[model samples]
Target chain A: MKGMTIIVKTISSWVKLLIFLFGIYIVLFGHLTPGGGFAGGVIIASSYVLLMLAFGREFVEKNLSLTASSRLDCVGALMFVAIALVGMFYGAASFFWNFIHQQYLADRATEFKLVSAGIIPLCNIAIGLKVGASLFLVIFALSVFCNDFRCKGSARELM
Target chain B: MSDIPLVLPAFVCIPLVAAFLLPILGSFGRKGRVVATALANLAALSLLAMSIASTNQFSVYNVGRWSIPLGINMVLDGFSALFLITVNLVSSAALLFSVRYMEQYTAKPKYLSLFMLMVAGMNGVVLTGDLFNLFVFLEVASIASYALVGFGCDDEQLEASFKYMVLGEVGSMFILLAIGLVYGATGMLNMAYISKAIQNNPTNVVLCFALALFIAGFGLKAALVPFHAWLPDAHSSAPAPISAMLSGILIKVLGVYALVRTIFSIFGISTTVGTLLVVLGVVNMVTGAFLAIGQGDLKRLLAYSSISQVGYIFLGIGLGGALLAAGASPVWASLAILGGLFHLLNHAVSKSLLFLTSGSVEMAAGTRQLDQLGGLAEKLPLTRASCAVASASIVGIPPFGGFWSKLILVIAAIGAGVYWAAALIVAVSVCTLIMYLKVHRYVFLGELSETRQQIKESRGSMAVAMICLACLCVFLGLVFLAPALRAELLEPAAKVLCDGVGYADKIMEFSKDMIVCAD
Candidate 1:
């Protein structure tokens, strides 16, 4: 039974990992394509939900904790703010401004690339992380409460 | 299209930074709540100050100093400043109310933080010159509100939150898709630039489709007749202060404001668009008023009334737009827009006061059912007094704010030769009066309920907030009577919309001049 549980958890983790990667792809391509941070973040968080549903609360909690997601959310928000503040330092006057003075970087950015469009791509990435982590925290907290309720119910029955 | 100013960006940033820092001080408990409240209040106060200070000027802040087409910008004309004042003023009052009211919930810090974030999002939506940024901020506010609505975490709260989220998400998606279409067509995200592009190419099928999408999306956000399913449930289920904030300001800031900005500033107010808005407004007025009259729940009734009030605003603005397109005098257009804007401010104060009173009532009596509540005029004198004042204002009693705005709208409609629309306005106002009378009859009049004999007035900050807004509702009519204030604030905003297609030129010229001066 332990081995089977381990296999199931591993499969769930792999599924989550795949979804996370897909979310990353979506975020990175947001400026050039239709999908953006919001879509990507929701997708990533949905993956965690799927994993929790498949492997149970304890299994999911052991693998993915609320603390980590909270930290990620904070960091993501900070990064976005930092990028916005950079506009001030670069004399761009407001947030989310691309400060590149060189024609080469601007011209070379025409091709499908990460550094193109200056701060938009980076902002998108930050938004994705912030959204993903916040969503995960919300879902995980609810699940934790759910587990606690179930545990209390079973213990009451035992008594 | 007036020169985008630096103050506009600060309106969005101050609350955002405050929201970000709120959670960091969470371990200090009461101290955390105090700090968050202070920060939010200070931010709101500063925004109010700046908006007041910049009332006569139109300024634009180019995001990153880039040209209009290349980067995002924040615009602060009279219109934006007026909205900023309304948003900030209500937010400050709401935060004050929450100081004592939120003790019932766990994690007071989180609630304050989310509240500020929601304010930030609404401020951003009002101030942003970029279409995409408006949508983004709209989502930010919507998501925060959804969470706040469910803050209690009860089964009903969660269910309401879920329903709200589903509808809100659909609205956001539609808005995003509209933005995508606009971007694809014009290759520009700035409102002024998009407006210019649309004017240069008025026959784009894609633009028309995008406009349709926007109306639907923003209409849903505003809780117009068809897309109003989530509002009653969500608004009623939220904590009372939140219900007040949502009904009083959220729908206006996110829905009516955005719709007006798009239709007037971006699309230059076509006849078809005007007709569509008028039709939608009429439908919302009748439907919302009728629905409100039927509601037994206090907050639910207020929520439905909000939809009806919003209908009046839309009707005023929409009629103005249609008249303007039909070659009516600019003076009438200004009058209509002024009425709409004035009503927006009046509704924010009065409705928020009403909701806050409801919160006080709920706190004292432990219920919101109208039939179960009675003779509160004696039990909770302060709450009863404020509710009476707010009810008077909303029902368009003389000397109150609502009466003046409704009068202005009716006269403006008649002046513009839309007599039928004026009649609709009057009819709806009558319906509104009847609905509020029902509320008063059931909630505050009649014999005192036996169960609520010991009910006392809500203590501390809630009372202070309600009194402040109620005073505003009573005195707000002076804004129109005073020419300096009206000319300094309302007239400039009205002129911006009246300027119509010239918005793009103004933006480009201002940005270019700034760049040249910098060089």
Candidate 2:
């Protein structure tokens, strides 16, 4: 498969970065705002999907391989679990125990602050990475297997 | 007992951590396979130990130290412990069997990961005290099973997966809708609060409607008679250990157990609901047995038998519910429920062994068709012996686990003066006997087929897994014969159901000590 027309490709290239930025913003501010890991992860996945749409499957595969995405997905989940376990280590707290805002942590995070809410931000970030990579991998594998979308002609022929 | 509830969440966590870790470990080369297998085995064993250790202990763990009725809780009552033992025992065995059984399939890591996820989901379902949380965990398990059913990627497996997914999703929708209705009416999602609300206003039309929807949804999930179109196909097409999991405990946990818990403990049992269950049980028993008699595929036959056995368990429970509703002796009700719960344990052990035996036969004979398999008694001695043991148990032969449970059910039904149900129970035992005889006559008794002459018995983990379950099948009956074990394990579970709506009261009482306000 080949890349799309110059107009579509150029616009997508600039828009993809902005979309990625927006997704990060949503994930980082998830504790204070409406969008959290799941929604933000989806937005991030869509940006990659957009990139794949403009540049074709090959270009994206070159940037991020399947294995790397899979590894990242696993790492993200492990990080979340690790955070939960860390809470347990502190005074034998419950599973998913949030201890980040405890009196032990030098200065406590105040209300409405990004660093507040104990482990919510960390959990959101882990879930964001996991859901994003997972969705991207799903799309990537599906696009790779999808024969109908494969080009039978060069980019110039259809345009 | 005070500290026991702290381990409740670990039941969900351990398998989850293993699930995510397996894939990462598998990304390494050949050495990763050994490491993943070791990790999976270790996880399964530890879970089984924890389940056994928590037997007969009840406590409620508030999530994140939040107070109950305000935050979600994990309840470790007798009912949960009974099902937890069944789930973890069968899952660990299945995982052991899969270590070798799945060698032929690519991506062993992914398979184990999915298996762990399914276990985690099931454990979560059994342990959760919230309604919506049940739905979420149910989804996790259902999605994993759907993926597993299609893991083979054959046309038949794919078709079966699609059909299972559609029906499963529909079932899930009904459950969610019911949950929504309950929440709308009661303004609470905690089961204890809902039960309390129902106790206060016992005759709401919407609550009744929600109860009806729950029956339909959970009945479909359980695959009782009318909702059983997917079981035969999905169970037969999946890889064998997975089939064992699906047939063994998945349906029991998600379908039968969930439905019973909702009806009896949450909404409170009634004569109408009890009669409804009895009727459904009779229909399922008759239908599943008749269907099994006609199946040529070995695993398909066992799958159908699963439906029949589940019918027996439900019949016993329904009889108890009916007796309770009639304001009869609580002894009879408890006896009936004891029979039901015992039969649940019996079936979980025996049916999984049956499926595993079928897997062994399929693996060695290279076919699951009864007509094509022959004289496995000579070539596959261990499988043949274990299969016979499982068959005997399923058929309610004397001195085995199945016989004791069936006898209890029959006695309870007769004592309750439900003579027809008693007769049906006996008749179905005979039907089960005939079905297993057919399996024996066609698959293991006849002269070895020429093409399968070179077949050999399965070795290593698969053999060990089957033999372990087979031994349990023979000894599990002793649970009834032995007073101490029965008093500790089976009796407590029966008491939980006999107590009915009292379940909420107990949880509420326990909640006072465990509740911690989230800051």
How well does chain B match by TM-score in each candidate?
0.97, 0.98
Model 1 segments beyond 4 Å from truth? A1-72, A86-139, A142-159, B1-6, B28-30
Clashes of each: 9, 0
Instruction: Summing lDDT over every window of 10 consecutive residues in candidate 1 chain B, give the lowest-scoring window.
Output: B1-10
Interface RMSD of each: 5.3, 5.7
User: How high is the lDDT of residue B65 in model 2?
Assistant: 67
Candidate 2 DockQ score?
0.46
Instruction: Give candidate 1's whole-model lDDT.
Output: 0.83
User: CAPRI band of model 2?
Assistant: acceptable
Residue B8 local lDDT, model 2: 88
User: For residues A86-154, could you state the per-residue lDDT of candidate 2 as single tens digits?
Assistant: 876676487777777663443754788777788889999999999999999988766655653475333
For each candidate, the DockQ is 0.25, 0.46
> Which residue pairs show collisions in model 1?
A92-B64, A92-B65, A94-B64, B3-B59, B3-B60, B4-B59, B4-B60, B5-B59, B5-B60
B1-519 in candidate 1: lDDT tens per residue?
332354566677777777766665553566766776677667767877766776766667877666667878887777777888888788888888987888887777678778988998998998888999998899899999999999887779989999999998898888999999999999989898899889999999999999889989998899988999999999999998898889888999889989888888897898888888888888988999999999999999999998888888888788888888988787888799889888888999999999999888888888899988888888888888888899888888989999999999999989988899889888888988898888888878899877878877776788888889989998888888889878887777778778877777887887787788768
